[model samples]
Target chain A: MRFGVVVFPGSNCDRDCYHVIKEVMEEPVEYIWHKEKSLSGFDALILPGGFSYGDYLRTGAIARFSPIMPAVMDFAQAGGLVLGICNGFQILLEAGLLPGAMLRNSSLKFICQPVFLKIQRNDTPFSNKFKSMQVVKIPIAHGEGNYYCDPRTLQEMKDNGQILFTYCSADGEETMEYNPNGSLANIAGIMNGKGNVLGMMPHPERYSEDILGGRDGFNIFASMINWLKGVG
Target chain B: MLKANIYVTLKNGVLDPQGEAVKKSLKILDFGQVNQVRIGKFIEVWLESRDQAAAIKELEEMSDKLLANPVIEDYRVEIVEVNQS
Candidate 1:
């Protein structure tokens, strides 16, 4: 599968994401500038994490207004697969492609460490490779990853199995202290209504190779490849 | 001309860590009576139309689509007529 990674100003993780997709996954990958308006040729898009627009105003706030966002919105609306990691997730929220908002970390500090995430729903294209309730280790580095939503929407997400992943301990056990950002219900990721768009705070691309850490995250992209193959 | 003031705030039940931090600072400074604080964003938008009704509708759409996250934020928009000499 061909992958297109969006490169915005202040995007620090674009290279890492590109390396993993091109080398580890053995998929053809290319960098797309944030100002470019067309995404017609790419099969999938990845918005990597970083301090986009220097996290000005708010994380992802200014980046949402970039010229490329209109095309990204159109891509996702047309059922194209889009994966947003870390600040990418925040940008998705700011762009209104995903629900909920990110707030400052409850601890009020930039947290950088390997975090465990429990897969809550594996039915979507993003997590179809994992079993429900399976735990995956990935690194999370951000200051505004706390997810907040109203009770009604939260209940709807729970009823619809939309909650994709939750923060957990390294051993896969759920714990309060391991909840790094104080995210409501320990939410680490979510999917859009159609399940084609995914926004997660953890960096799955960073851990896709065994050399960097583990290969658990490799399975996520692999699942996407398999899905594309099945469709094609 | 029309003037609109928008107040955006995190809805009740959602944690406001920034506001919490400021509240903690207030207590640290010996303001013991302060119990709670909530942080919000304010924006003033000026439009060329003098029609209050049209301006309110347009600003509301802007707020819903971009200015606020309805999932966690509540916004109030007030419209007023601007005087021109």
Candidate 2:
């Protein structure tokens, strides 16, 4: 599958994401500038991490209005796959493509470390490569990764099975101590109601290779690859 | 010209770690009588229009769509008129 990684000014992880897909995964990938107006030919879009727009005026507030967003929104609305990691997750929430909003880490500190994750669903393209309840280690680096939603939205997401991953122990136990940012319900990742778009705080691309001290994240990219092959 | 000064803050019931830290510092500085302390942002938006009502409406729209994330924040707008020197 062809992947397009959107690069906004101040996005530090665009190159990392591009390398993982192009060199490691052997998949076709291209850098999509923030000003580019089209997502016409890509099978999937990625909003990688970093302090976009220097995290000014809120983390994703300014980046949300970049020229490429309308195209990104159009693509996702048409059932196209969009995966937002880290600050990209912030942008997705700001753009209303995904539910909820991100808040400052409850501890009020920038956290950068590997944490265990419990996969909650495997039917979606983003997690199909993992078995239900599978545990994986991924790194999260951000100062404002806390996720918040109203009671109604939270209930709706729960009922719709939109939640995809939660911070958990190495043995797959979900608990408060494992939550790095005090995200509501230990939520580390979630997809849209339709399950086509996903926003997660953890950085999968950072841990997709053995050189990075972990390889569990490789399946996340593999899942999308297989999903595209099946549908395409 | 009409100026809209907006204050954005986390909504009630949401935890504010930064505010708590500031409150702790204030107490340590001998201000223990303080019952509460909450921190927020103040934004100034200047409008080049004579119609105060229109400016208020527009500022309200701006606050709702971009200035604040309703899920976690609440924003208030006030219109101030500035006199040119």
Candidate 3:
């Protein structure tokens, strides 16, 4: 399956995603610039992490208005797989492709460290490779990773199984202390109701290689690739 | 030209960590009367239209579409000045 990694202005993780798809995952991938309007040949899209448009106004706020976003939104609506990481997730939230919004990290600091994420579900295209309630170590670097949604929307997401991964202890316990960003319900990732679009604040590409200190994130890409290949 | 000043503030229920930090600092400075502090954005926009109603409508549309996220923010627009050259 061909993957397209979107490259927005100020996006620094596009190359990392490209490398993971090409070198690590052995998949055909291309970088799509933010000005490009067509997404005809891509089977999947990855909106990689970085401070797009310098995080001005708000994180991902200006980037959502980029020329390529409407096409990305259309691609997602057509049941195409779209994975948004970090600032990419913020863009998805701003574009209304996903529900909720991100707030400044509770500590008001840009946290860059590995944190434990509990796989809330293993049935979706993004997390199918993870065992049920599996805890994976992934690094998050951001100032606005605190996810927030109205109580009603949170309840609806909970009922619809939209929540995919959440911050937790290494032993897989969801507690306030383990909630690194003060995200509501410790949410670190979520999928839309249709399950075609997934957004998470952690950088899976950064840890997809064992040489990078951990390969716990490799399964996320593996899961997506397997699902696309009809193996899952 | 119409100069529009837009104020974007987080919704009442949403938490504001920056404002909370400022409040804490103020409390430490012995400013005991400050009960709450909420930080928001102030943006200035220049519009070519001179019609007040139309400019207000356009500014509202701009706020709804881009300037503020309705999910967590509430915005207000004021046509602060009208300039003619």
Report how far residue B56 has shifted in candidate 2, in Å. 0.8
> Candidate 2, residues A1-232: lDDT per residue as tens digits?
6999999999999998999999989999999999998777899999999999999988999999999999999999999899999999999999999889887898899999999999998888999989998998999899998888988899999999999999999999889988898899999999998899999999999989999899887888888888889951
Give, for candidate 2 chain A, the lowest lDDT window spanning 10 residues.
A223-232
Give candidates' CA RMSD values in order.
Answer: 2.7, 1.4, 0.8
lDDT of 2 by residue, B1-85 (tens): 7778999998998777788878888999999897677888899988888787888899999988888878779999988776553
Candidate order, lDDT descending = 3, 2, 1
Q: What C-alpha lDDT do the candidate models reach, one value each? A: 0.88, 0.90, 0.95
Give the range where candidate 3 chain A is weakest over 10 consecutive residues by summed lDDT. A223-232
Error of 3 at B44 (Å): 1.1
Query: Each prediction's DockQ?
Result: 0.59, 0.74, 0.91
Question: Can you tell me the CAPRI class of model 3?
Answer: high
lDDT of 3 by residue, A1-232 (tens): 8999999999999999999999999999999999998889888999999999999998999999999999999999999999999999999999999999999999999999999999988988998899989999999999999999999999999999999999999999999899998999999999999998999999999999989999888999999998998887
**Residue pairs in candidate 2 whose N, alpha carbon or C atoms collide under 3 angstroms:** none
Off by over 4 Å in 1: B1-5, B44-61, B77-85
lDDT of 3 by residue, B1-85 (tens): 9999999999999999999999999999999999999999999999889899999999999999999999999999999888877
How do all models score by TM-score?
A: 0.88, 0.97, 0.99
TM-score of chain B of 2: 0.90
Error of 3 at A139 (Å): 0.6
Candidates 2 and 3 compared: the better one by TM-score is: 3
How does chain B score by TM in each prediction?
0.93, 0.90, 0.95
Candidate 1 global lDDT: 0.88
> Which of 1 and 3 is ahead in TM-score?
3
